[model samples]
Target chain A: MAVSFSRRIRSLAPVLVLLALCLVIASTNSNFLSVSNLIRLLSAAAIPLVLVMGATFVILMGSIDLSVEGVVALAAVAASMLVANDFTSLDLGFVALPAAMLLGGLLGLANGLLHVRLAIPSFMTTLGIGFACVGVATAILGGFTVRISDRTFRELTLGRLFDVPYSVWVAGLCVLVAWIIQERTRIGRWVYAIGTDEHTARQVGVPVERTRILVFALAGVFYGLGGAMSASQLGQGHALLSQGRLFTTITAVVVGGTALSGGVGSVLNSVVGVLVVIVLANGMVLMGIEPFVQQGVQGLLIILAVSLALDRSRLAVVK
Target chain B: METFREYLPPVVLVLLVLAVGAIEPGFLAVDNLLTVTADTMTLFLMASGATFVIMMGGIDLSIQGVASMTSCIVAALLPELGFAAVPVALFAGAASGLLCGIVSTRLRIPSFIASLAISGIVTTVAYWASDTRSVLIAAGDRDSFLAWAVGDTGPLQNEILVGLVALLLLGLLLNGTPFGRYVRAIGSQERAVVASGIPVERVKILAFTLSGLMAGLAGVVMAGRLGSGSPTLANEFLLPAIACIIVGGTAITGGVGSIFRTFIGALTIAVVRIGMTFVGVSVFAQQIVFGLILVLAVAITMDRSKVTTVK
Candidate 1:
């Protein structure tokens, strides 16, 4: 018998996986699917969603962004400090957002420049930038949490539309921007082309190094936004709390059906992956599953997801 | 004169020690030096193990997870099973990494992703066993394995001696054995090796298994030092371990780095970390410095000829 192929089925796998997981989680507890709970999950996933989207571009180019956690922490700290708060005597008003963005962008810029100019691998450069950011954040804050009371920043996160939080809107805007950039721009095509074959792309006059730098810079921007959003929601910034997000972001992206090997992922996949992971975490927490067990399950899901999505054709041996 | 090439790395280490010592007199203290050296032993073992896998042009992200899982098993099983638990714990670690290697070889996932998946599975399973809480091996049950960490020596510590032993033995294996040659062939060009009739999967699996075993050794040592196991116990080790391997100048692209280089890298990282704390650098500044050093280390040591692209 001949099997019929369907494009819709090909794309629906991620959505179905997410929905099935959500259904199972929701069935375990009534509160799992409650608006408030889901709202929390979405917000939690949003920071990673933005970061992973940024990461996708780099990974698409066969590079990665491990500096996210550090950048996010730094940006979060900056946001916390600059906002009108009990702990902070300074308020840069709205300038705090861009100021935070600048700091994150500069670190990313350093990472990109090192890779392109100094010939360092993106892995090492990004790793260094991340640690540097963490060191800077810890030094500035003195290991203390900075609580933000800026009404404007708070309003952006705490405000809601049709009972959904402002964060969801911000996240939606980010996804839209990412999708547009990926779909319409020549740079987007370059991203895919470069992933498929960097040498050929360069031969055709694609600005490989510049595009690579821009992608990292873009990732830094997303990280900045994500970190600032985190500060707004928590009304406080803590360096240590933000350090645990890299493995989570990478796992979420992989689970959503993005290939870590590059050239085969979408922003949509990341969003759904974020939802799947965040929901699992939030639902498990709500279900009173031990944090340890939840962590284990998450690890299992990462392996399972990659096993399912990895394309065997490109690789001859796994190593 | 023939030995000058071999002696270069240690000479560098000595200079680094002197430079650090000149800046701060406290850097040479026995307690601080012993602790740093002890902490590095785990990574030393790991980097040595991975040096072989990397020499085959494959990477292992599963080291920390394997270590975590091994420690978790040791912590959970020690009192009930005594010394019998060590083999079981080690076997579990090796098996987890073996599964990852198998996934890469059979399922055709890249080693990086395959090892990542394995890390996920191992860490998750370990977490479930430990419940995020740190569990210590009962004092009565720890005498044998704790000996691997430290007992005593005339003037030096035994743990450092063990690290040297693991390195020397493995370095001999890599440089002397036919398996090492095959791994190098596979790493440098697998297609050519397969066409020549080498059993690629066998060598790949063996390398990963060795990597797992080394990580297990690290875990056992870590458990002895910390006197407990926790879900996130080996998490911090991942970066420093990789950083040390890279800093010792092992190419990440893998077919050319030596265990000797990795040993040096581990020691360098351990010294920097300890030195930072002693200098009273705040935790945040320490993070920033580690980050910068990771990049700088890679920049200094990475082999540009092997890595045409920075992936």
Candidate 2:
């Protein structure tokens, strides 16, 4: 009974932290709870929220995907250039969205293949792929931002449905899809099994390699969608469109109670984690903290969160 | 296969040199070759230190951040402390590495995550210290104290000479010392070493500290050459340095590498970059090539038998 009770407390820790943080910030600044500010906060979180949702799957398998920034940058640039843009004669209209996502899936497929086939560590493979993707994006960009002129595409960012941006709705849809995959699918269960114990999973016929590759491809799709949303929000896309997002998204997923060790945490946890991170950033700005200091604080927060969420007993060594 | 893998780096280096020389004869000229060597010094310094940690089956991603932070420290303190600032910066760099080592080992966090977080924090410190701008070292101080960095010694540039000396000393340290053997042993098989009652944690920490010191040295040299420092000054070095280690035929799986190999790797990278320019490849496209090369090298040199599961 005590073990189950303590486990319940541990599971609820992230929620409690989010609640406590909100109360503290709200008490310090009453405007923090205002509906307008809350909406702004959600909008600010939309892109990262989508990103975190994708990253959670990779992390759930105990493998990391550092290719988020690169995938997003490439997808964004591809989407912008394909649409009615200032740079080129090409205008694919609504087709640009799926096209961009397909590009991301291809890149993610490459990332998965390299890691699984070559047996390179996921971090190194993903990091290298990320760099390559960024380079490709830069090459395509030619040192220019492709501005989107299509009103319908821009509506993803500007138009509101029931007082929420379309981007947020997209993010909500991602959460719902991800939750369904996690709770209702065999691949989701296979991912947890592989992360929990690869040898055992392999023994039990979990199709480790295929599942790993598929998860990476799935992650790429979400990153592609995120890129499109970002391009819509900013009205332009460039090689640096998703700069600094690698750290932010990874931090969000890890802080949301997902262990870097894998096989723990959920889509809902990551969603709440995204909210926590965004609110923390917003609260820091309201408190007048320097931007540089805020980065340092986030850094410390990552270390603290990872240490707290780590499952030491599962490992014979912590490499 | 073992023998071929061992000889691959030097063979590749020679091939690259010949290929580049074939494409552009001027690439072989003494002056241009000297310039390439000089350009490789900073990367060589950073990668050599990282080689030690990599040999131990751990990695130090914070080297670039430490280099940038120390560069900021050197630039910020030059006005007040003059030559004294260099050591202080180096010490601070080592201290940061120490912190990373402590966090990873003591707290049981993975080295990559710990180093990444620490790098972010120190990079922030660098920004805060330099007021988020490039801090320039005064010309008077540069000529007086930093002259050794830019001045030529006989035929070779001072920076090249410094790099060579670092290569020699670090090579000796790794090959001649027990700590060096322990690093390899730990990397090759940590569980066995731990059971054998070796002080694995202490050695790991020392290796990290040494890596940090070398990064600091690289930063000081960079500041001396450029006469300025900023948080982002060494930002571009990270990938190239990692590329150097892997390309030089060092196993990313840990163990089975040397500082001299990293030096060769650094030269290979510099030559590749210069060669790309000679062949009319756009500067932006070079990174894509390097990324591809990095993956290829790791694939070639990885020790598959060591890791039971690749995560």
Candidate 3:
């Protein structure tokens, strides 16, 4: 009983911190607890939440995807140009959404292929791919923002179901899908197996390469969906739409107790972590902290969280 | 013929130069060559610093932030402290690097994560120091340094000369010193080095500190060239610097590269960049081509057998 209890406490540590932070913020600014402020916070977290879900998969495999900003930029621009937009005559309407997701998947597949087939490090593969994606985005944009005119798309953010935004609903669906994948799937189990010991997993007949490709491709699709949602929310497709999501999402995944060395943590842990980060960001803004100081505070908190949550036993060397 | 693998990058670089010269006769001109070498100095220095870290099986992502913070400090203090701000900026960068080293070594965090956080911290500090504006050094305050930096001594640009001196010094440190041997051993096998009782942690920290010092020097040079500084000044150097290291035939797995190779690699990148300009490739297309080249370079140079699992 005590062993289980200790295990439970270790797992719940991030959640406990999240609650404590919220309580402190609420005490300082009572409006923080109000429904409107809460909704606003949820909406702000919507895109980052989706990004965290995608990042969680790659992180689970002990590899990382630094291509988020690039994929997001390309998908957002391409989707904008394809849908009812000022730049091109092509009007794919809602179909543009899936097409954008496909673009992201293709790029993700490229990343996977480079890592598995060419034996390139995921860090270099994703980083290079990201640069290529940004170039594609720039090429597609042609130095102009394409104003999105699709009414249904615009409603992705403005529309509400019982007072909650569509973006929130979209994020919820992503979270549900991610949770299901994490808890109930063969691929999910294989991910942890591969991360824990790739050599042993390979010896045991695990499909390491195929699983890596699939997860990266799936993550890419999610990033695409995120880019589309962001474009719709802003009513335009800008190539630089996902400027800062890479660091933010990675920080979220790590802070949620996902060891960088891999083979531990879950989507649920990441969700709690995402909420904590988003809440802290929102709260800092509410408290009138300077934007620069807020960034400093966020950086300090990331170092603290990672230091506290790091499983040093797993990392023989913290390279 | 394993030596053939060592010669591949240089051979490719020469062929590329020949191709560019055929396409644009101006690319091979003496004046253009000098300009290219000078422009590549900053990248060479940054990559030279990174070679040490990568050789130790660690990576540094905080160069951009450290450079920016250094630039900000130099710009803000130059008017008051005059030439004295140079060391201050260098110290600021080294201090940030030391902090990163402590976090990653003592606290046992990954260098990438620790450096990334330090970058954010320094950037915030930079913004506060500069008040979110570009700080300009008056012409009177900066002209002497600028003259020395941008001016040519005979045929060689001062920048090129500074870079050459840095190249030799760093090469000597990496090749001749006991610290360099320890770094290489750590990269190849940490357990072996630890068992050897070589003070692995201190050497690792020193490598990061060297990287930070070089980045600070780059910042100082950039400030001299631009006559101004902003928190975002060094934001664009991160990718190019890493690309230089990889393209220079340094293995991302570590223990298999040198500062000399990075020097050649920097020249290769600069040649390509300038050659692209001569060919009138669109800036966006150039980025695409650069990305492709980076991917290809890593694929060619990486020791596949050394990396059992590419996580």
Candidate 4:
């Protein structure tokens, strides 16, 4: 009973922290509780929420994907240009969304292949790929912003259903799909097995290499959808479209009680993590803290969260 | 294969210089070569320090932040403290690195995440210290104290001389010191080092401190050269410095590299960067080239047998 109770509390810790932060922020600023502000907060979290979901899977496999910002930037640029846009004559409309995601998936596939085939670490592979993606995005943009002029496409960001933006709904659907993949799929089980112990997983007949590749590709698809959402939200796209999202998304996944060592936490945990980070940022802004200081707080927060979430007993070496 | 791998970096350096010189004859001119050597000083400084960490099978992503922060400190304090600010900045850099070491070693966090988070914190501190703008050195100070960095002595720039001196000292330290041997051993076999009863944690901390000190020195020289400092001063150096280490044939998995190899690597990067301009490659495309080079180099040079799983 004691062991189970302690385990239950450990699982509930993130939610407890979130509630505590909300209550404290609400006490300090009454407007933080406003429904309109809450909606605004949720909308603001829409993009990062999507990004965190994708990163959660990669991190779940004990491999990191630093390609989020680059992939998102590329996807955003591609989506902006492919849809009814000022930069080019191409106008695929809704088709542009899937097309952008396809590009992202391809990039993700390359990342996985390079990591697996070459036997390079995932972080290094993703980091290099991310840089290359940024370069490609920049080259394609040619130093110009591609603005979405289609009102119908822009409605994905602007239109509200039950006072929540369509982007939020899209993010919600992604969360559901990601959660389902995490909890109800054979690939998801393989991801956990590999992350827990790759040699053991392979010995148990898990298709480790294929699963790793597919997980990265899956992450890319989410990043691609995120790029489309970002384009819709801002109604424009450039090479820097996904700036700073990488830090926030990774931080959110870690903070939501997901271990960086992997095989722990779930999609729902990342959702809560995204909300925690978003709420903290919003609350700090309302409290008149300097934006620079907020960045420092976030840095400290990640360190603290990772330290808390880390299970040190399983590893002989931390590095 | 072993002999070829050993000779690859120098051979690549000579070939790159020859290739670029062939395309742009002016690139080989004595004056242009001196300029390229001087241009590589900052990257050489950063990469040489990072080489030690990488040699120990760890990495220090905080060097860029440390460099930027130290530059900000030097720029902000130069008028009042003048030459004293340099040491202050160096101390700050060392302390920042020490913090990373403690967080990683004591808290048992991975150095990658620890250094990355610390980088964010230091960068913010830099932004706050500079009031989100560039801080300029006074004209009087620039001519008086800062001349040591920018002024040329004989045919070589003072910056080049500074880099050479640092290289010599670092080479001596790596080859002539017990600490150096321990660092290499720890990187190659941590379990063996621990069994040998060596104080592994202290050595790791000291290596990080050395990395931070070098970053600080780079920042000071950069400030002197630019005549101003901002939080973004070294923002572009991180990837290139990593490129320098890997392209120079330092195994990214650690334990098989030298500062001299990084020296050659830095020159190669400098040649490639400047040569691209002469060859009319778009500035935007250079990043792609560096990224591809990093992946390819790591793929080629990685010690695959070091780990059972490539996480």
Candidate 5:
């Protein structure tokens, strides 16, 4: 009973710290507490929030996806080219959305296949695939920016429902679906089992490879949707659409107590982690901190948070 | 057959050169070949440092960030301090690397994540120092190290000579020293090495620091090569450096590989980079090919036995 009690308290610690941080930031910059400012923060965090959710799935399975940036870039360009864009006369309208997502899923499938079939490290495989995606994005871009005139898509992202941007709503929906998948689904349970011990999981009759591939493929779908959403927000698609997202999503997921070694975190934890990262950035900006300085501060905070949050016993070997 | 595997990378490199030259006769020109060697110098230096980290079953992603910081520092100090700024830049790189090692060792953070954070910090520092602008050394002040880097020394480019010297030094350190043996042993089996009373943490720290030092020199050399330093100067080299180490046949699993092979790997990359341009391959297509090649190399060289499961 005492052990369970302590574990509960331990889990609650990160949320408490997050709340305390918010109060401190609010005290420092009173405007940070404004409803409008809060809304703005959510809007800014919408894209990263989606990416983090996808990354959460991959991390929970004890593998990582470093190809988010490249995948997004490719998806963004592909989406733009398929829609009512300046680059090509082809106009697929709402169909472009699914097409973009399918591309991302395909890429994710490739990532999974390469990891399982070729036996390459996830990090290396994702990284190489990411580069390939970037190359593909560049080729599609052809040294020119493609402007999107898809009114429905733009309105979907930029349009606010109940005084909040649609992007946030989309992010919220993604979080909801992810939560259900993580908690209720057999594949999700298999992800946890595999992460805890792949060999044991396989012995227990878990479909290890299939589950791994499905998780990656699902994560790719999220990344693809996130790319389309980003293009909507920016009102165009460019090859560099996913710039700086790799570190941001990884940092958020890891800091949220998702073990780098795997099998020890949740969507709820990452949501709180995302809020902390976003609020921190928002608060620092409000305090007139330089963007570059904020990055350093964030880096320091990750090291501190990771040090505090990680379970040492789980890490028998540090790679 | 065993000996054949050992010489494969160099043989492949030579074949690539011959193939490219046959396709484009101008690619074999003395000027073009020399240019390729010189261009590969900084990459060679960066990979030389990273080789040690990988050989120890760790990865260092802080190369570009450390190099960026080194370049920024070198650029800012060169106007007044001239050549005296070189060592300072190297020290900064080594110190940053040491900090990364401490974080990884003391906190038990994985080296990749630790290095990633370190890179961010270092890159931020570079940005703050340079104010997001490129810094240039006056042409009149470029006669010393810059001239040496760009000039020919005997039959080889001076930058190539610098890279050769680095390769030789790292070779001796890895092949003829206890430190090298410890690194390989630790990578192959950490529990056994720890039981043997090896100061594993300290050795890991030193290896990381040495890699950082090499990155620093690479940055300074890069600054001299371009006659300017931009905060993003080495951003593109990170993947290539990792690719070079792996392609040179260094096991990503960590116990087996050499600096000399990394040199050949760097050469292979340089040829592909320059040769593609000569052969009319678009820059984007080259990136695609690089990505493919990296996957191929890792697929070929990865030791399945060493890594029970590829994470």
Candidate 6:
């Protein structure tokens, strides 16, 4: 396909953002150039990247996901119990990752079902679902921690391959898979079409309802996977995993230059969005800026980035 | 359709509470009910505030951050501020809400993203200000906070009274005032209102300002309840506050939800939360139930034709 200059810019967005972040980090600290830190950066970016990848598909379809964080906490706590450490060798929480994924998928599936089937607005569906999911997670743990002790899963998350962290590998594979699904599959085409125009897409024979449900379910898999891997890193399941999920995922998506208005973005956009967010956090850490201030600044930056990138032409009014 | 459906959510909530109480004998107790009501008030403040924003079809995500920040601020400012603490804490929260509104309306960023940004900024600022610790209300100020927090002028707790007062004031403003009508009109159709010569921008800005004011009040009440200001004190209230509004029958798409319904919504949330614990529902299951209820609430009460698409 011949790409327009604008389309090219949209595609190049992630690279541009990554390069810009690199230059800024390099300028702020010479030590940022070290391969060790670079890998660490990639790893740090990976978690949010997985999350943003999940969110981007929803955003591309012109909706949102606020439930990932809640699901993550539920999933992470589930993962924590499974690692076979202090809690129990025969852990259901460990199996809870798939359960969490199923739960998350069901939640997302609900979001899509309510969205297309019942016609509840996407914003409302996800918001309500996120709350419900978090409430359930808290109920399960009773606000306590579920620790993971499985050496194998921990190694899977922490272990390195060819000097690369496992997190990076997992995140990279996810991105690749996401890209393939977005570009090559029939489902992918339906997704793009729906985001562009739900009615027109439906008229053109896209299974809008089926595609949306699938996309939301797909997002659940990421949240669940992220939750599961998070156990490897922390060895505990805490419902806190999803605390700032809505803000962070949306921020990363916009930072990667994805339009909040839907129909125009890529998996690479998510990769870059997550990278930029992590870069900002990591750079702030390196600069010794207070963590709280860093959060506030990141929040402000997200608003700024999205405002700039929003395609107002496509939106008669933004809600 | 609107008239009958308007009462549906509250009725459902009443029935749900009755159901929960019937299942678990412990849920019907007064002392337990009072505490739950107190907890509900904190979110009620935020929901009442958010109702204004929602009526304008704009959502505010800063309720949690502002509440958390105000708790920290009140605790930190106690030595110098004294009884003046109430105004200052409320001011701080509202200011944060105002900033969010400015970011959304002036910059043309959507309220969802704008408020999300504000939540981030406020949470961070609160974290920094509190030095990542809860700030204790000084000894001299402790009595005053107690009076506000636990004092009983009569049957209701002080904080609960304040919430009721807020509810009355906000309800009147939402129903009886021109501002209220404009808000509803804005929610129904922004461009139409603008075309009709209403100052859509000002209405929006004011809606957010009102939201901020309510959050500020909530923060103060929350501080009183905790008896010490901690950033995390009101952090947990975020989901519940929004949930209360949604479950109270407010449209996530905006222009349709009401503060009156949200009042009942807050009560519903409180009852569900406190009742579930007493009913022997596990905490994790409670969280799941909260999420599930929100879906159910929105599913049943939401006006789908009003919004052309989700998100």
User: B111-184 in candidate 1: lDDT tens per residue?
Assistant: 76677667777877787767666787776667665665656676667778889899888888877898888887
Model 6: runs farther than 4 Å from truth?
Answer: A1-14, A91-107, B9-39
lDDT, candidate 1, at A283: 73
The DockQ scores of all candidates, in the order shown, are 0.53, 0.69, 0.66, 0.65, 0.67, 0.64
lDDT for B40 in candidate 2 is: 87
Classified by CAPRI criteria, candidate 5 counts as medium
Candidate 3 chain A, run of 10 with poorest lDDT: A293-302
> Regarding lDDT, does 2 or 5 come out ahead?
2
DockQ of 4: 0.65
Ranking of all predicted structures according to TM-score, beginning with the best and ending with the worst:
2, 5, 4, 3, 6, 1
Q: Order the candidates by DockQ, highest first — what do you get? A: 2, 5, 3, 4, 6, 1
**lDDT digits (tens) for residues B83-190 of candidate 4:** 888899889888888888888888888888888788888888888878989999887887777777788898889989999998999988888899889888888888
Model 5 chain B: lowest-lDDT 10 consecutive positions: B141-150
Which is better, 3 or 6, measured by lDDT? Answer: 3
Every candidate's lDDT:
0.77, 0.88, 0.85, 0.88, 0.86, 0.77
lDDT of each residue in B58-150, candidate 2, tens digit only: 878889999999999999998999889888998988998888888888888898888888888888889987999999999998877777777
Model 4: number of backbone collisions: 0
Q: Please identify model 5 stretches exceeding 4 Å from their true place.
A: B278-280
Chain A TM-score relative to the true structure, per candidate: 0.92, 0.97, 0.95, 0.97, 0.95, 0.92
Per-residue lDDT over B1-311 for candidate 6, one digit per residue giving the tens place of the 0 to 100 score: 88877888779777877888787767668876676677678788888988989877778877877888888887777777777767787888878888888888877888877888888887887887678998877555877654766567676777678777888999899899999999998888777887899877787878887887788777777776667777777766766787788878887656787788899988988777766776678776776677667766767766666766565
Docking class of 4: medium
| Top-DockQ candidate index | 2
Per-residue lDDT tens digits of candidate 5, residues A110-135? Answer: 88988888888888888888878877
